[model samples]
Target: MISVEEALRIILEESKALEGEEKNILSCLNKVLAEDIYSRDNLPPFDKSAMDGYAIKSEDTDLYKDGVSIELEIVDLIKAGESSDKELKNGQAMKIMTGAPVPEGANAVIQIEKVEVREDTLHISEKVKNGCNVIKLGEEIKVGDIALRKGTLIRPTEIGVLASLGYSKIKVPRNPVVSILTTGDELVEINETPKFGQIRNSNEYSLKALIQNLGLEALSFGIVEDKKDTLKSKVKEALEKSDIVITSGGASVGDFDFVEQVLNEINADIKFQSVAIKPGKPISFAVIDKKLFFSLPGNPLSAITTFEEFVKPACEKMLGKNMESDNTFPVILAEDFKEKEGRSKYIYVKIKAENGKLYAYKAGSQSSNQLITMSKANGIIIMPEGIGYKKAGEVLSGKFIFK
Candidate 1:
């Protein structure tokens, strides 16, 4: 068995960023930009109005005093999506709505509420500064200017910006196709009642949910018998149809654990068969034909934890996303915890923020097969591989799970 850090290093070294394809802007949400996007036109194509008010020359309001008001004739009215070609004179103003194009020779706009109108005339007692309430053309972005840089994640705001810049489609890295294969004769369908020694298969469902949480689709091959030949054929089939194949059982050293054997038989480069981590120690990683393969323990919690720690990074790299950042932080323990002193332990806990400091408390039993314990936990505290027990008031690294 190798350390978790070394195993992850091998997996990431083999994962490659996939090529990009053109897609509608709406479909590119949460995806990384494949290239820099230049603005096709000025952000505000014309001198536009930022408010519903009168467009006038700033010089026209220069004579206004505290008690005295200045009046300018209202010549034309412009609403949103409308343009006026009529130019304003020294004492003329145009009633313009928000988003309407400001008429030529108008250098400022006085808000409608700030001014009183008396029969086609505008009245204002305050001096209007130049460019006031006017969204100048190209103020935000100019034609041929870089609007968005490569590797930027597309959000809702990016969608609107792309649309405003006349881009209906964008190029983004393709989401990888992931397949889940569950193995074990002792497992039955979720809807089926398990016999005396059998148990319902929850690993397949949990794996699918985890894959979907990354915005990728999952194809699951129902439970395969513990037979060597059958599992081998299914593994080959899954690898042939998917960019990443995940098997949820038969990864340990038991007689029926055939993942490592099958990987060798298939001529795959089996990088590692185990990691020094609790609840998810038996994890097999391999690569063949540009496809990633991960064999996780049959325990439901182990399967989910290994997937998040190992498989999730491969998928993220294929999608051209940042792969090195984690949300871990120093958290003070509020309860004592016990464990063996060999592998790293991920203890599920309920985290609370008190006075700007995070404190972690035990949620329930730290059993490897208990998914309920994980469900009750909002976060996890990482215990070092050299420590067997942690006392209350001790500090350790903690981070939220499934995020």
Candidate 2:
């Protein structure tokens, strides 16, 4: 049995950076950037008006001091999307609407409501500062400036930014194709009635949903019998088509656990097995022909926890996403915690802020098969080996799974 850290190191050593591909900007949302995206041109591109008002010179009116209103001739009326061909002269102003290009020689803008227009001449009623209500050229973003850095994931706001910058395509990492498999003779479909001691298989559904939530493609290979031949055939089929393969159940140390035997039968290059963790000690993982395989525990909670701690990160790395832990916040124990020594343990707990301090309360039960306990829990409190029990108010590091 390898330590969790050593197993992780071995797993990470097998991973390589995913390749990049050009994708349509619309399809690039939520995709990781492969290269830095630089602005093709200055934002706004030209000096434009920011308000639906007239453009005038800053010194056109003596309104800066006692607010002297000046009468100026409105030579042109420029609305949004229109440009003024005529340049403003001393004591002259252009009636420019919002988003319209500011006329040359105009240093300020006075709102139309602030002026009383009589035929061609306009009377300003308030002081106008230089460059007021105007969006200068390259004000928001300059040309050649990097709008987004490499490895950055594009979101809706990023799409908007790229659209505003006139980008129709973006370079993003190639999303890996993943296949999920489950092996058990005592498992049946949810819609079918279990015979004798068989139970409905929940691993496939939960694992599929978890994979999809990570923004990747996941395919189910259906359930295979726990027999070595059936398991081996299923593994080969999934490995032939996918970059990563995940299997749940048949990973424990029982005599019927054929996952390890199946891998060895196919001459799979075993990477690591049996991580030093509670509720998930029987996890198995291997790398065969550059493809990844993960054999999760049969217990639902154990499967989910192992997926979050290991499989999720592996998938993210394969997708070129910079994944980080969200549950690094300091949390105090709500009550005393006890456990056996040796293996590291992860206990589900409900975390909330109480009296301006964060506290964690243990969930109902610690049974590996209890999915309801995990559903009611908010986070996992990590208890490393040799540190068995913790008293109330003891500070410990934890992670929020649903956050």
Best candidate according to lDDT: 1
Which parts of model 2 have CA positions greater than 4 angstroms off?
Answer: 61-64, 67-71, 110-129, 324-327, 354-357
How high is each candidate's TM-score?
Answer: 0.93, 0.89
Model 1, total clashes? 0
Which residue pairs show backbone clashes in model 1? none
Model 2 residue-pair collision total: 1
**Candidate 1 per-residue lDDT over residues 1-403, each given as its tens digit:** 7887898889889898888999999999998899899999997888999999999999988888889999899999999998887988999999999999999999998898999999998888899999999999999999999999988889999999999988999999988999998998999999999999999999999999999999999988989999999999999999888999999989988899888889989999888888999889989999999899999999987888899889998998889887778679999998888888989888889999989999998999888899999999999999988898889898999998887
Candidate 2 per-residue lDDT over residues 330-355, each given as its tens digit: 88999998988788888899989899
Which number leads on TM-score? 1
